[model samples]
Target: MRSDIVPVLELGAYAAHIPYHMTWAHEQLPYTPEHERFLELECISDILEHLL
Candidate 1:
């Protein structure tokens, strides 16, 4: 995992998530902005943790 893959995944997840997860925006959507951002944060954190 180069770490950047997560963004690509999350994007694909967001795009495909609607039909794959069968979710709607108001109906507790599986892909939330906050959650995706959280994953980004986690990815950066993991990178920093590995570097330091």
Candidate 2:
């Protein structure tokens, strides 16, 4: 778990920690800011859907 993300989640901010897919472990994907932002938005939308 990312300790940096823990604080945001614990503090009830609009933040999320998304787990990587098993396939990601088999492939070498470049970790970039755009990818991170996309994942964060995806997780946030998922959480919102669950809540609402």
Candidate 3:
């Protein structure tokens, strides 16, 4: 199960397991030149973006 769907399941709500062939923009991580060096920073950025 996807991590995004866990909260809904925990609430005892119904959720369908649908697979997609294409990736959505929001689902895609931003590209960075220094991927290895800034990996943790990138993750924090993603989390903050989602929160907002």
Candidate 1 runs further than 4 Å off: 13-52
**For residues 3-49, what per-residue lDDT tens digits would candidate 1 score against the true structure?**
33346566765211212334344545243454433333333345454
lDDT of 3: 0.41
Task: lDDT winner between 1 and 2, please give it.
Answer: 2
Prediction 2 TM-score vs. true: 0.29
TM-score of each: 0.23, 0.29, 0.34
Cα error, candidate 1, residue 14 (Å): 12
Worst 10 residues of 2 by lDDT: 30-39
How high is the lDDT of residue 40 in model 3? 27
Model 1 TM-score, all chains together: 0.23
In model 3, how large is the Cα lDDT of residue 1? 27
The whole-model lDDT of each prediction reads 0.39, 0.45, 0.41
Ranking by lDDT: 2, 3, 1
Question: Clashing residue pairs in candidate 2, if any?
Answer: none
The residue-by-residue lDDT of candidate 3 on 1-52, one tens digit each, is: 2344445555665443333557676654444222221212223345454346
User: In model 1, how large is the Cα lDDT of residue 6?
Assistant: 46
